[model samples]
Target: MKTRKRLRSLGVNMIACLLSLIMLIPIVLILLNSFKTSQAASDMSLALPVGGLHFENYTLVIQKGKLGVTFFNSLLYSSGSVLLCVILSALAAYVLSRNRSRLHRFIYVFIVLGITMPINFVSLMKVMQLTLLQNTRIGIILLYTAIQLPFDVFLIYSFVGKIPRDIDEAAVIDGCTPLRLFYSVVLPLLKPVLVTVMVLTFLNTWNEFVLPLYFLGSSSMWPMTLAVYNFFGMYVTDWNLVSADIVLTVLPVVIVYLLGQKHIVAGMTAGAVKS
Candidate 1:
């Protein structure tokens, strides 16, 4: 029985590893072929470059695509939006979860509705124009914050509910004001959920193309993803440059995920189970 159980576990592990490799093959192919010339890539897409390392593709893409500027814009937009979402969501969730009232429940339901409702681009466009937010980085950032608020709020609320009420009561007894209690007592305890919100928000905003495309009309304001799309269109035949751009665009998120995978998994699982 012990031998059989061990064999079953090993089999499952093997299957999981195989599936992971299968999912990673495309990414690996793109990274490898990014070094190859267009002809080489077309001839043998799967194989790595034959003639040593080719840094030219990276240089060309960076220079011609203006990837540096676009990358900075993406970083600014994603980071700023995620920061705002985490702060606002954490505070909102704390209030809703801690303060039990009909109004709190209504607000929670409204936030959930934000998550359920599909983004209406037509209506959104009109709102953008009315708000004078069209064709601007700030517009994209604000839109991202609004779109992502629901999920972030939900995650934080669930986690906050798991926290004991004694903490809040004790803080209040100690002459801590509401804002001070939140910033000093509650925020620290909600670190896990905050990390989860930050990771999700960053990924969504970084990969978001539709909003940026519509709101950021100036090529100078394009994010990395949109810039990559433009690069592909202009250099349709240049597979090397295209692949390099893809690698560059995706590398940051990949690195972030790798670094924070544990926190993300733990926070999400804890929130889901607690809720």
Candidate 2:
């Protein structure tokens, strides 16, 4: 029995390591190729760089891609959307979780329906036209907020429900207003889930391509993903620059995930075991 258990453990470890390598291989290739010259990259696609590093590809991509502007645009869209989503979702979730009523159930179902239905691009476009949100940052921000709300509300509601009602009662007894109780007491207890929602929102907004492609036509307004796509179109034969752009686009998300992985896991697991 001991030997069987040991073998199973060893097999699982090996499989996990293999899966990690499989997932990492493309990223590794992109990083290595990003440093090669176009000629060298094409000629020895799989080979590692020789001697000194060739950072000319990075310089060229920076110049050609207008990466700084694209990165800034991404920052604005992602941060703004996330802020709106978190605040609105938290409020809505708190109301639904703490105030039990038939109306709360109806609202919950309505929000959940948003998650189930596919986005109607045609209808959304018409709505955008009426609202004059097309080709505007505010429009994109609003759209992202609406699209992301359902999941955010659900996640936050789950966490909020797990918090003790005694806390709210005590705060009210102490002459705390609803807003004060929520802002000062409830919000702090929701930190874990809020972190998870923020991280998820950031990633989704950052990687979003189609929405921005349709709405943001201005080159100056392009985000990292759009910038990378434009770079590829212009430099179709320049593999080195393409790879470098890919690396630049992917690196930030990777860094964020690594930094927030612990928080993300804790947030997701917060309500799993009732305290």
Q: Each model's RMSD to truth, in Å?
A: 2.1, 2.4
Candidate 2 per-residue lDDT, tens place, 1-275, comes to: 99999999999999999999999888888888899878777753668987667898898898889998999989999999999999999999999888889999899879967877898787888889899998898999998899999988988988888899999999999999999999999999999889899998888899998888887768888899998998999988888899999989988788888988886676556547766
Q: Give me the displacement of residue 46 in model 2, in angstroms.
A: 2.3
Tens-place lDDT per residue, model 1, 229-274, is 9999998888888999999999998998998898678655753563
By summed lDDT, which 10 consecutive residues of candidate 2 come out lowest? 266-275
Steric clashes per prediction: 0, 0
Global lDDT for candidate 1? 0.88
Q: lDDT of all the models against the reference?
A: 0.88, 0.88
Any idea what lDDT model 2 has? Answer: 0.88
